[model samples]
Target: MKLTTKGRYAVTAMLDLALHHKGEPVSLAEISERQDISLSYLEQLFAKLRKAGLVVSMRGPGGGYQLCSDPKEIAIADIIAAVDEHVDATRCGGLGDCQDNRRCLTHDLWTDLSNQIRVFLSGITLADMTERADVRQTAARQVKRLEMVADSAR
Candidate 1:
C-alpha cells in the first residue's frame, strides 16, 4: 500500500533528529530546516509522537526534542503510527469486522497483505534508515569531489 505524506514526513523528521543527536534536545526549527518540513506541521507531528513516547520535548533556550530511546530501538512502524492516525493497508474502514462482511471476495488477500506490511515496517528501525542515508550522503560527496577534480584538471 502507498504511504501518505504524513507517514513519509514522520520518518524524515525522525531521521533528522537521529542525524543531529548529540545527547541533547534538538529544536523543531532545526529539524524542520533539515527535512524541509514546515515548522507548524513538525510541531503538530511532534505532539503526537511525544504522546506516543517515541519522542520527548523540552522547553527552554537549549530545549527542543529528542528520541525517547536509541534509534535502533524505535521501529518505523512506531513513527508512522505515532504521526498517522491509521496504518492499516487493506482495511475497508477499520480493523474491527471485515471477515464477515459479505461480497468481500479479496478480504483474505487484504488481510494477508496487511500482515506482511506490518511485519516489513516493524522490521525496520529509524537507525536503519539513518545508516542508509549516511552512506548515500558520503557517496554523493565523493562523486561531487571527483567531478570537481576532473573539471579542474580539464
Candidate 2:
C-alpha cells in the first residue's frame, strides 16, 4: 500500500485527539509532542480535517481542537480521507492504467487489495483503537516520558 506519512500522521494525531479530548480541546502542540509529529504539518492536516467536518477548532485561552462526534462514529478511513490521503495499493491508483494506459496483469489483484484495505480501515474507528490495551499502555508511556522530560528541564 502507498500509505504515506501524511496518512499515518493524520491517523496518529486523530487518535491522540480521541484519547485526550475529554470534553476539552486538545492542542496540536501537545499532540505533536506526544506523537513526534511536526506542529506545522498538523496544522495543515487539521485544516483539511476541519473542512471535512471530522473535527472542530476552538479559539482563545485553552483553545485547540475537538472531534465533531463520538470517536466510535469516526472511522479511520474517514480520517485518512479528510487529509486527502488514499489507501491505494495499486500502482495506477486504481485507474487501471498501470502499463502504458492499459491494465497490467496484476492490476486486478492490486485493486482488490486496495478495496480490502479501504474496507478494513473503514471498519475501524478511533474508539476501537482507543479501547486497545496496548494503545493505552503506549499513550501512558508517552505521557510519562513527557513528564520526565519536563522534570529534567525544570
Candidate 3:
C-alpha cells in the first residue's frame, strides 16, 4: 500500500519526538529541524494527532508537543488512521459491493489482503519498530563482516 506524504511525515515526526524527547516536551522546531519536515506541516499534522488523543500540545516557551501515551502503545495503524489514510492497493474501494451485483471476481482477494495489511499494521507498535531497527543494524553488521572476509580472500 502506498502511504501519502502526510502519513509518512507524521510518523517520522512522531518518531523523532519519541527518540529525542524521552517523555519530555519537545518543541515543534526541534522535530521539524531534525526530521527535515516543515514546521507548518508539522503543526497541521500534530493538530490531527492531538485531536485524536495520540499526542498533546502545550503552549508557552519550552512547550511544544508530547505523546499522550507511551510510544510502545502507539501503532502505525493508529497514526495512519488518525490521518484518514486508506490502504486500498486497488482503487474503486475493492470493487463494488456484492449487493450492487457488480462485485468483481477478485473482490474477496483484495478485501482479504486489505484486512491482512490492516491487521499487520495494527499488530506492530512503535516499540516494535525500534526493535526492528536494532535487528536491521545487526544484520548490516553481519553483512559488513562477511564482505570484509570475502575481500580478504580475494
Candidate 4:
C-alpha cells in the first residue's frame, strides 16, 4: 500500500504533540515547525481529527490542540483513518478492479495485506512510540539542529 504524506505527516505531527505536550496545549504552528510539515495541511488534518474526537481544541492564548485521551488510547490506525487515509495495496482500493471488468488473480492477496497492515497499525499506540529510544533520539537531533540554526541566525 502506498502510505502517502497525509498519513505519515499526521502520525509525525501527533507524535510530536504527544512528546512535547506536558499538561498544556500544543499549538499547531509548533508541530508544523518542528515536524517540517505545512501549517495549512496540519490545519486540515487537525480539523478532521477534531471532528473524529481524536483531539480537542482550545481557544485564546496558550491554546491549541490536545489529545482527547491518553496517548495509549490513540491508535495509529485511528489517526490514519481520521485523516481519511486509505491503506489499500490493491490498485482498485479493495474493489477488485485491477483487471478490466474482472477481478485480478491476486486481488485477495493484496486485500489481505491491506487488512493486515491495518491490524498492525491498530496494535500500535502513540505511547508505544514515545517509549522508543530511537524516536526520542531523532526528535532530540532535530531540536539540537533547530537550536543551532537559531543561534547561528542571531
Candidate 5:
C-alpha cells in the first residue's frame, strides 16, 4: 500500500512525540519544529488523534499533548487509522470495483496484500521504533538541521 503524506506525517510526528516524551506533554509546535511538519497540519492530525483516544491534550501553561497510553500500547496502524488513512493496496479500495465497477481478476490478491500491510503495521509500536539506534540518530540529525535552518533564517 502506498501511504500518503498524511499517514506518513502522522506516524513521524507520533514517533517524535514518543521519543521526546518525558514527564510532560509534547507540543505540536515543538514536533513541527523538529520534524518539519506544518503546525496547522499537526493541529488537524492531533484533533483526530484526540478523538480516537490515542492521545490526550493538556490545556494550560507548558501543555501540549501526551500519548493516552504507553508507547508500547500505540501501534503504527492505530496512528494511521486515527488519521482516517486507509491502507488499501487495491485500486478499488478493496471494494472489488477495480474492473468497471466489478470485481477485478486480482482484487483478492490486492485485498490480501492490504490486509498483510495492516497486520505488519499493527505489530509495530512507537516504543519499538524508539529503540532503534538509527531512528534516534536520524531524529537527532533532523533536529540539528532544523536548528541550523532557523539560525540562518534569523
Candidate 6:
C-alpha cells in the first residue's frame, strides 16, 4: 500500500506523544522538532485527530495536546483513516475499474493485498509500538539531538 507522508507523519507524531506524554500534554512544536515535521503541518494533522476523538487540545500556558484515550486503544489504521488516508494497493482503488472502466486481471489480487495491509495495521496500536526496543532507542536519540540543538542555540 502507498501510505503518504500524512499517514506516516501522523503515526510518528502520535508515537512521539505516547512516548513523552507522561500524564501531561505534549506540544506540537515538540513533535515537529523531534520528527522533523513542520509545525503548521502538525497543526493540521492534530486538528483532524482531535475531530476523530483520538486526541484533545488545551489552551493557555503549559497547555498542549493529549491522547483522548489509552494508546493501546488507538490503532495505526485508525490514525491513517482519521487523516483521510486509504490503504489501497490497487490502481483502481478497489473499485474494480483499473482497465477501461472494468476490473483488471490483478484487481482481486491488489484488493486482497489491501485488505491484508489494513488488517495488519489495525492490529497494531500506538502502545504496542511504544513498547518496541527500537522505538525507544529512536526516541532517545531524537530527544538527545533536540537537546543538543537547544544547547547550541544558547
lDDT of 2 by residue, 62-96 (tens): 99999999999999999999998988888887888
Q: For candidate 2, list the clashing residue pairs, or say none.
A: none
Q: What is the C-alpha lDDT of each candidate?
A: 0.80, 0.95, 0.78, 0.93, 0.93, 0.95
Provide the clashing-pair count of each candidate structure: 0, 0, 0, 0, 0, 0
Q: List the candidate 1 regions with Cα displacement exceeding 4 Å.
A: 94-103, 133-154
Query: Which regions of candidate 5 deviate over 4 angstroms?
Result: 146-154
Residues 26-143 of candidate 3: C-alpha lDDT, one tens digit per residue: 8988777556689999999998999899988888878988888888999988998887777775445765664456777777777888889889989988777656777446545654
Kindly list the per-residue Cα lDDT of model 1 for residues 61-148, writing each as its tens digit.
Answer: 9999999999999998888888864556565744545557653667667767777887888999978877796745954565467668
Residue 141, candidate 5: alpha-carbon lDDT: 95
**For candidate 3, which ten residues in a row score worst on lDDT?**
135-144
Per-residue lDDT of model 6, residues 1-154, tens digit only: 6899999999999999999999988999889899999999999999999999999998988788999999999999999999999999999888888999999999999999999999999999999999999999999999999999999999
lDDT of 6 at 37: 99
| TM-score ranking, best first | 6, 2, 4, 5, 1, 3
| TM-score, every prediction | 0.79, 0.98, 0.78, 0.95, 0.92, 0.98
Find the 10 residues in a row with the least total lDDT in model 4.
93-102
**Candidate 4 stretches greater than 4 Å from native:** none
Task: Give the worst 10-residue stretch by lDDT in candidate 5.
Answer: 92-101
Which candidate number would show the highest lDDT if scored against the true structure? 2
Model 3, stretches more than 4 Å misplaced?
94-101, 134-154
**What's the true lDDT of residue 122 in model 2?**
96
After superposition, candidate 6 runs with Cα above 4 Å error:
none
Query: What lDDT tens digits, residue by residue, belong to model 4 across residues 1-154?
Result: 7999999998999999899889999999888878899999999999999999999999999999999999999999999999999998998888777899578999999999999999999999999999999999988888888888889999
Span of ten consecutive residues with least summed lDDT in model 1: 94-103
